[model samples]
Target chain A: MTTTNLPAAATREALGPTLVRLQQNGANIVVVDADLGKSTSARTFRDAFPERFFTFGVAEQNMISAAGGLATLGHTVIASTFAVFAEHAFDQLRMSVAQPKLNVKVVASHGGVSTGEDGASAQSVEDYALFSSLVNFTVCVPADVVEAEAMVAAAVATPGPWYIRTGRPKIPVIYTDGPRFQVGKADMLREGTDVTIVACGLLVERSLRAAEALEASGISARVLNMGTIRPLDVAALEAAAKDTGAIVVAEEHLTHSGLGAMCAQAIAATTQPVPMEFVGVQSRYGESATWDEVLEIMGLTADGVEAAARKVVARKR
Target chain B: MVYGAQSGHIGGSMSSTEILAVLYGRIMRHDPKRPGWVERDRFIMSKGHCTPVQYATLAESGYFPVDELSTFRKKGTRLQGHSVLGKPEGVENSAGALGMGLSFGLGIRLGMRLSNIDAHVYVLMGDGEQDEGQVWEAAMAASHHRVDRLVAIIDRNGIQNDDFTAATMRTEPLDEKYRAFGWEVRAGIDGHNLEAVEEALAWARDVRGKPALVIFDTVKGKGVSFMENNPNFHGAAPSAEQFARAMEELA
Candidate 1:
């Protein structure tokens, strides 16, 4: 295919836009990848700037470790792979690399069960939990294209190593072009007082639909797009618990060690703990089904999220 | 080779001697005095067990006095069997593990590329290190990112710590393996051919859009006749007579 030579201000995919920004900014950004270039959309970078890019065949651990060495010498190395292979670089990522607080960006595409038809082995069901446990690293799961672009830019500019979980599908652009995004702050899409729904990544759209469903039933549900999962929007979470007295956490990963666990543990710190319900894959593997089927199987649909919200609200009563 | 002084990883060191010689003599962009110079290229021995050759090269290159090479393996010397971080001079990463050099080179290459600096990263690995799954991961990664500024030299000595590489675990079709991974693989060159090694180094330095892997068909103990291609010398330092004979051949 011909190269995409879009206008300077034209809209583009998250990875493309972020790469362009890095080019313009003269940032010392490098994209290291496994053999899955077509999947991760890093071919554009290779075509545009051949020198600044590196492909490490399939060595995930060495890729991460090398990224660490590069970061030590003051380069911003962006290592990309499926979330599964990226997770395989755990020991280096946790102890030998990220613990030293290296300035490396691990861009894990095909996050969650979004790699539909590739089966459960390719699907990363525990990526969020795995990355969340790493101290001092920013954990981001942008919901849509706009949010993805913002998160990628923020991740590049953010200090320390950042784990950005992105999906394979072309998600709807939920937020506007300039949707006031930050590293730790939550975006309040719709406000209500009966129940608070905190979601991130692709599930943000589902959570918004769920909130609308609850609204049709005369229930006011506050929706917060918790794009940043690690330095979790704690103030917003506390407000949700205090105002609604009930909360529901939704993501596309495992229920345990995800946003649900964070909200539950955070809310418990308060005197009036809000009853929380988690909506995600309840500790199971996925098959190579379509995206819709996988979501249906894992109960990540709007109706499913709405059901969890209802359960949490009933517990409050 | 220095008798009791060659007490750690002598065979692999001897196998890699010629490659190390060519690098220090002509290929590597290093400054003996200013080891951390910004534009200077880096050499990370990820398969670090074979540091005696590196120490020998460092001594010859004037990074330190050749007389100091005798202190190797002695207590409190900076030159340990495996490379350490605090060693004075051009030593980059403190690598003790296998299959990590390519990754370290990846980082340095990325750094040099990002800053608009003209530099390269060269990493050396052993034939047996191919067993570590992480090596293939790094190989694929380097190809995907197209980090042409990095060069990997594999010392195909055909032996590991114990037995022959083929008898222990075969890594045949080495060049095609790396080529299938998308690297610009060049193999079957003699590691001792200073001219050939120089030409390969020049080509690797100029080639862009792909990392280069040069597989040197090296003997286990290259310079010494008795120990050449012998797996028993892989990690054992030569005795006094053996060292004398090896030095006599070098002379």
Candidate 2:
């Protein structure tokens, strides 16, 4: 898909309108916010559906448990809060929502170091890892607003527990139109055979840019937007390893437990194992800075991905 | 069942037996034959460690065969160590971790209100479970929403796992605390007395525009002579000799 003229917007900005649409379409959807309706863009749903929206004041645990209760009664509940704050309700989410396979969509905003100026405490680089470890959880990190809206619809249509991590800042538009997003399916943005640049969330756009740069340098790079991390698309990873013989995984989360780890495991089990390079936060906390600055410090840029792609391609032989 | 399983919260279960009996027998509009009836009142046992009483009540109420009580805590059985929803027809929520039932009950009550279903949600909690911060969070929300269909009953057996609640962590002035949190508080009622339990629930049902709580004051192991007020029985199952003695005492 061509990226030119694609509309750029924050993932959080698409949450409210998308939820309203879901409710309008006869979905028994209820929106729950933990005093972050404005920040998480849940206020859009709150303003539209006053009766269906519930504001649990800074109480993420109670909000999550209540969401579970509401889900048990056959309500499709969307519980929103900052990604960092969602950690407070981990136990509740695990037992009440995940274990019971309740239909609760925990949409956490301000994911990763992109939540600039809030410092280390506000950044949630470990959310994907935390949620993916739970039983019966579908973990997603949409690359752009188009994917975000489609993912919200998909999450509602799909039953059971879901965890979606969205960024605070506006991300580059990767899809001109709403992409067909299926749980555990990867979107191949650009196809190549030299090396596959696998990425998710904010880093997907960076990987696309790196793929373009690699193309100019006479190196073909395949870009796979791995939106869903938990129910990971292992087939795509295996196909990439078989077709390209090398892989480079990138994410805004820590490299150890995020997409990189999942991709490594997938590749190791393939018929022909491939060499891989990881592009993510190297087991460290983010500081208070602009999103661009944090990206540069964490080596989460197109240049870093391009460099990793080159290194992995060299190790292929 | 506890003696048969050789593992259970016997003390807390004994203390809460009458409350469960009253709920499943005299109160709560529920049909044993139609356990999945849409308008049935929901019952959540927040202090889920005490499953023996709930299992007994469910059997006595005919929600399931009384013979199934023998499978409590056994492998591949619905009656696990803690309460699990859908495992038993009447078990509204799964609980083992303390201090989550009120929040879940509040959600059920709110859901019933939205669905236009006139049903009450009853949450049975342990006095020691109040120490968890999540309990107060749910309390504040229950009151803030004015969930009138919600009723929280605290089994104040005065003992925790290791010692008495007074010595472990002072949860005194609980009635004042609930009142401050905007709930209609009914405290100091004898949990063993069926008439008192019935009256408190009736009063709570009549309350409008606010949640209600009934604090039951009772001995830990009320029916058992040697187990009464004994912390050893808080989480231990009866031995062969002790089991015989208990059956005789209750008989």
> Which candidate number maximizes lDDT?
2
Worst 10 residues of 1 chain B by lDDT: B1-10
Best by DockQ: 2
Q: Tell me each candidate's TM-score.
A: 0.69, 0.98
In Å, residue B49's CA in model 1 sits off its true spot by 6.5
Q: Is the docking of candidate 2 incorrect, acceptable, medium or high quality?
A: medium
Residue B115 of model 2, lDDT score: 87
lDDT of 1 by residue, B53-123 (tens): 88889889988888878788788887877876437477776666677777777777767666778788889
| Weakest ten-residue segment in model 2 chain A by summed lDDT | A1-10
Task: Give each prediction's DockQ, rounded to 2 decimals.
Answer: 0.33, 0.76
Between which residue pairs do clashes occur in model 2? none
All candidates: CA RMSD (Å): 7.6, 1.2
Question: Per-residue lDDT of A68-145 in model 2, one digit per residue for the tens?
Answer: 999888899999999999988998987788877899999999999998887899888888889989999999999998
lDDT score, candidate 1, position A47: 74
Candidate 1, residues A84-117, lDDT tens digits: the string is 8889988778743555577888878888887789
Clashes of each: 25, 0
Worst 10-residue lDDT window, candidate 2 chain B: B85-94
TM-score of chain B of each: 0.95, 0.98
